[model samples]
Every structure is written in C-alpha cells, then in structure tokens.
Target: MPNPLDPSLATLIERHTGPVKQLRPTEHGRGSDLTALAETEAGAVFVKAMRDRGRAGGRRDSLLREIAVAPHLGGLAPALLWGEADSGWVVGGWEAAEGRPVDLRPGSTDLPAVVDVVRRVGELPLPEVAEDWPEQRWDRFVAPGEEDLFAGRALLYTDWHPHNFLLGPAGCWLVDWSWPTRGAAFISPALLVVELVAAGHQPAAAQGLLADCPAWSGAPAAAVDAFAAAHALMCRSAADRRPQQPWLAAVADAAECWAAHRAEG
Candidate 1:
C-alpha cells in the first residue's frame, strides 16, 4: 500500500528525525485516522495522524488533548516526542512503547500490574489544562439529581479496555490519552471493573481485583452505584448505535452486570 503519511507530513517528520528509514502503517485505533511506526535516525517513534476535514477532523481535538496531557502523565504513559499541525493534518510522534496488551481475565498474572498502573494514574495531580475538561461523557446517561456524584479533581484515564494497558519487561504503560478527563478518582477503577467483567470475570470478582486501590477503597458506595448505572446506559446506547459490533454489546452486558451488582450491595 502507498504510505499513508502525506508527502509533506513525511518531509516535516524527516526534518525532526532525519529520513524515515521505514514506515509501517498500523491498524486504526479508536481515535486516529492514520497510525504507524516509523524507523528514523532518532529511532522508532509511534506516529498518529488525523485529517482536519470531515468526520476525521473532530479527532484533531483529541490529538491536541493528548499532546497537552502527555508531559503531565509522568512515566505512566508513553512520552510524546514531538507533535505538530501542518497542511490540514494533526500529527504526533511518541516514544514507541514495547509491550503486549494486558489480560483482564480472572487469575491472569497481569492483573496486579494493571491495578498498580491504575493506582498510580489516580494519584497524579490534576493537570491545569484539564481543569475545564470535566468528565462529562456520561452526563446524559447519569441519573437525574445525581450528576454531582461524578465530580472530583483527579485526572482520569477514562478508557479502560485491556488494550489500553500494555505490560512488558519495562513495566506497564497506559497508552492512549485521547479522552483523558478530570473526574472522581474512583472512576478509573470502576471502569476497569467493567472491562474485567467483559473479559469473563464475574462482576463481584472484577471489583475484588482492584479492592486495594486507594481510589476504589475510598469510593462512596452511592457514587460508585450511580456511575455503574450511568456507564451501563452509555454502553447500551453505543451498542445500539453499532449493532454489528459484538464487543460493544458485550461491554453493555458487562456494565449492566456491574450496575446490578452495585444495586444489590
């Protein structure tokens, strides 16, 4: 296939890292129009690009958000090597992270590392740039009169799918900051519980995996219950919109299971 990187974009990247020795187009991720790993004089850098027109244009904002939050993430996420916008495209190059996506199944050894990373993320001080980006993705789904339950000052890596957490010799790194949010700290662990459930663990067992996490342990029962219900609604709506995606429907089922478990408690 022709290199998806525009000629001008390639020239721009070359200016920063020398000639691209090789460029390998990668599978599309949730937020990127074009993604690849490019070998350059500076070494391997993961590149993500999005066009500034049509539906793809909206994702440029996500890339900008990731650029802003990258430095503040400490070592929990891959470092952003460089990012720039030119010729109607937003592009970012990040330190190529080496790891395999974590396993969220019950009894998986990767569980401990997953919990550790989520805890560290919750402990990070909220980034100033995210102050106005309150966690509102679930607003429409939240129960009436309970919107305040999701309020907090913690930085949340709201996307909790197994692929988002990579485990390797170096350690676990949470990738993808496209939708990072400022919200109640417990929201991270709670979202993880949903993924665990989707990965074949029972709802109660999933919650147990993160039982020791400070955010999870300290979360108010009422607040967690509200989030569980709202998240289930959100997943169901997404599944409805994309009926062909079995994964979305599966997640909707998991969220429903978690919400029911919380209601029972």
Candidate 2:
C-alpha cells in the first residue's frame, strides 16, 4: 500500500528527504498506528504516527513518553530524527533499523543478545519525567500487598513480545519504547521470562536467561515472585474482559505458569 501520509505530513517529509520515492507501510504495530518506511536521498527513514498518544496498556500520556524517551536511547533503539503533530495525530521519524523478529524458543542464540539489549537499555539515562513505579501500575492486580518489588530507578520498556524486537546485525535492537515504566532494572528481564513461557519456554529455562544480568541477580526472590503473580492476575483479567482470542488466552496461560513457578520456587 502507498504511504498513508496525508499531504501535510508528506510535504513535511518530502522537504526533509526530497520528493519521496517509495513509501511502504509496516505491519509490525497496531492498526491505529501508522508505521511506514520512506525511501529518501539518505536511505530509509522509519516513521511512526498514531491517531493519538497511547500504547496497549499505558496512560493517555503514552505518546508524550515515547517522544521524550526516543532521543536518549542511542544505539539500543532507533534514533529519532524529527517529530511533529499533524491533524489530530502525533508523528515522528527515526533512523530505520533492519533485522528479523527475535525467535524466543528455548535455546535460541538470540537470547544472549536480547539480554545484552536489556542491560544496555537499563543503563540508558532516565527520561526527565518518570512514569509511576511498575508496582503501582500492577498493584490492583496483585492480591493485596507486595508493592515494593516494583520500585527502582531504572527506565523499563514494559512491553516484551517478539514483534517489538529485531535481532539486528549490531545486536538485538528494540523498536518500541512506547510504554516505558519507571521501575527496578531487572523488571524488564522478569517480564521477558513471562513472554518466554508464552513463546514455549519452561519457566526455569526462561528465567535462566537472566543469570548473567547483574540487576536480575541482585533482585530479591520474593519481590520477583510478587511481580510474576501480579502480571498473571493482570493477564487473566484482560483475557476475561475481551472477546475470546487465542493469543490473549495463551498469554494468560503463560502468565499463570510463571506465577505458579514463582509461587512454587
């Protein structure tokens, strides 16, 4: 399909990269979001435009978070070139990253690279504005107490599905920073463990991926267990409320396994 950019947005890009030659829509994100690759004199520039600012499970200010965090991600994420608001939408252009989606199977080589990315992202400078601590966000889902486990100084990318990653040449380049959470440095890795179960990994095997990360090793066991339980409750609640979709049901099952594994551990 042609680039979905309206004349105003198209004019804006054309002015930057000369008359656009090829515009291709990307299928990696939600339907309401427009991600496209535009061929220009410099090469391919990735563009993301949302009808409004929000991600799958974020506050209404999600668009603001993405815009604020994009500039500081350095090599771990695509660099933002420019951004603007156009006709009820927020749009930005980024240095395009090329790679295949990560395969999160039990013994995939990509695991190590993903771990490296997690550590690097953990090291990135915190955005000026921090979102609420992860514990606060997941608090309602947990049984009653156990909120301290989610508090930390690190910037976290809360969404961890395979589609959000691209195992590129330099390393595993993470594409979406839409739902950054302010929390423990190890939280991202912990979230990855749950996703691994959804992707067919046993809990122990998936948790093993975090062994080398200092943050994950430093986290208290009880706190980690609390996070797993909270995530499980959140996933189950989501599945229950929505139309019966296989992926949601499957994720809920994965969350259950991780939470159960944590409980048993």
Q: List clash counts for every candidate, in order.
A: 0, 0
Give the runs in model 1 whose Cα sits over 4 Å from its true position: 1-4, 28-30, 54-57
In model 2, the clashing pairs are none
Q: What is the lDDT of residue 173 in candidate 1?
A: 94
Could you tell me the TM-score of candidate 1?
0.95
lDDT of 2 at 149: 66
Least accurate stretch of 10 residues (summed lDDT) in model 2?
Answer: 52-61
Best prediction by TM-score: 1
What is the per-residue lDDT of model 1 for residues 1-265, given as tens digits with 9 covering 90 to 100? 1356678777767766788888887654845877888887778989888776644425788888888899999899898988888877778889998888888888899988998998898789998999988888887887676888999999998888778777888999998889788889999889989988999999889888888889899999999999999999999999999999898999999999999999998
What does candidate 2 score on TM? 0.89
Cα lDDT of candidate 2 equals 0.77
| Model 2, runs deviating above 4 Å | 1-4, 52-60, 131-135, 143-145
What overall lDDT goes with each candidate model?
A: 0.86, 0.77
